[model samples]
Each structure stands twice: as C-alpha cells, then as structure tokens.
Target: DAGVTQSPTHLIKTRGQQVTLRCSPKSGHDTVSWYQQALGQGPQFIFQYYEEEERQRGNFPDRFSGHQFPNYSSELNVNALLLGDSALYLCASSLANPIYGYTFGSGTRLTVV
Candidate 1:
C-alpha cells in the first residue's frame, strides 16, 4: 500500500538543459497526473496519463511531456529548461472515478541556475 513515489527528490539544472522526473503510482491506481508547484503557489496541473496514453493536458507548453507505463508508473520530461521552470514537481495517482482524491508524492524540487 505504498503511496506515489518520485525520484531525484531534488535536482539542479542549468538553462537550456533537459530533465526527466520519475514517479511510481500507488497500488491499484491506474491514473497518473503531474503538477508543478512554485514557491508559495498552489499546484498547477501539467498533464494526466491513463492506459499508457495522455488523456488530458494543462496550459504548459509542448516542452512538458509525460508518459505512463503499463505498471502505472510515469515520467515527466521537460526540455530546454528555464529558470522559471524551477519548482516542485508533484506526481499524483488515483482511480478514474473522482470518488476519492488523488494521492500525491513527496515531489521533486527542480532548480535551474
């Protein structure tokens, strides 16, 4: 009964570099969603994946992409990173139905120098 887990709890990258964040959904969860949370701000949806396909996306640019594997694990890739992209990347997992809220990971803090 583990919760969502994200790797590289913290990362430091430079502008123009690319970074990939990883996440493993909780047991029995089939949907995975990614969010970006800036300091003192709420989490902003990036995209959601289900059945190994992207089902919904947020206002982020194409540089932000994600993939869900058959095991319900997921990855978030950001290309040409910008300083503004520095934030806490959160991964959440839940069932397709909204009967229950999402279970979030500890989050990956990215800093672009």
Candidate 2:
C-alpha cells in the first residue's frame, strides 16, 4: 500500500552541472510520469514511462533524460542544469493509462544556484 516515493526531498545544484532524481511508483501501478513545476506555476508534464520505455514526452529540451526500471521505479536526469531548471520535480504513477487516475509524490525541490 505504498504511495509514490521521491528521494532527497530537496536538492541544490550549480548551473552547468548535472543531477538525477529518483522515484518509486505506487504499488499496483505500472506507469510513471515526471513533471516540473516552477514557482507559482502549475506542473508541466515532462515525460511518461511505461513498460520500461518512454511512452510520451513534453516540450522539454534534450538536457532532460529519464529511465524506467523493471521494478517500475523511475529516474529523471537533468544535464547542464540551468537556473530555470530549479523547481519542484513531481513523480506520478498510474495504471496502463493515466486517464483513469494517478498518484503524485511530494516531489523533490531542486534549486540551481
């Protein structure tokens, strides 16, 4: 009965550096999605993962990458981080299709100094 879990809770990175955030999906869920939420802004979908593959992506640059493991856990990797990359990174998980429902983690607050 575990819900989605995100690591570090908070993070701080320097511009031009790289960092990776992790997420463990809720039980009974097979899909994972990543989102970025800037201060005062709604979450913006970054990408979706299903069956260990990237099923869909949003309007983000190549600097963003991700991975889904056989265990259904996922990771979000940001390279050459910029100040704009600082935000709350959320991880949501659902069934095969998220149109039904999903659960979100508290997210990892990232700050690019």
Candidate 3:
C-alpha cells in the first residue's frame, strides 16, 4: 500500500561527478518515469520505462539515463554532472495504462557545488 519512494532524499556533488538516484514504485505499478524540477519551474519529463525497457525520452541529453527493474522499481543516473544539472529529481509511478494519474515521490534534491 505504499506510494512511490526515492532514496538519498538529498545529495551534494561536484562538477563532472556521476550520481545515481533510486526509486521504488508503488504496489501494482509497472511503469516508472523521471522528471527534473528546477527551482521555480515545473517538473520536466526526463524519460520513462516500462517492462524493463525505455519507452520514451524527453529533450534531455544522453547524460540522463534510467533503468526499470522487473519488480518495477527504477533508477535515474546522471553522468558528468554539471552545476546546471542541480534540481529536484522526481520519480513517478503508475500502471501501464493509467486510470488516474501517476504517484510521485518526495523527490531527490541534488545540489551541484
């Protein structure tokens, strides 16, 4: 009965370092998607995964990647991070054919210094 969950609620990294953020989807959910929210801006879609395969991707660069496990959990990885990459990383989960809307996690706040 749990909702989406993200690990390392907050992280601090330096330029050029890599970071991996994790997320556990809600029960009975099979799709996982990632988003990035910069300060005042709304969440921007990064990518989506279903059935362990990436289904759709946004305008993000190749540095942004994700993986969906068989259990429906997921991970978002950012390589060679830049200060501009700092943002609130959000994870959303829902059924493949969503009835309502996706359940989002509290989000991982990444600070690049």
Leading candidate by lDDT: 2
lDDT of 3 by residue, 14-74 (tens): 9999999999999999999999999999999999999999999999999998898888999
Q: Could you estimate the TM-score for every candidate?
A: 0.98, 0.97, 0.98
Q: Count the clashes in each prediction.
A: 0, 0, 0
Better of 1 and 2 by lDDT: 2
lDDT of 1: 0.96
Alpha-carbon RMSD, each predicted model: 0.6, 0.8, 0.5
Worst 10-residue lDDT window for candidate 3 reads 63-72
Off by over 4 Å in 1: none
Ranking by lDDT: 2, 3, 1
Q: Where does candidate 3 clash, by residue pair?
A: none
Candidate 1 C-alpha lDDT tens digits along 40-112: 9999999999999999999999999888888999999999999999999999999988488999999999999
lDDT of each: 0.96, 0.97, 0.96
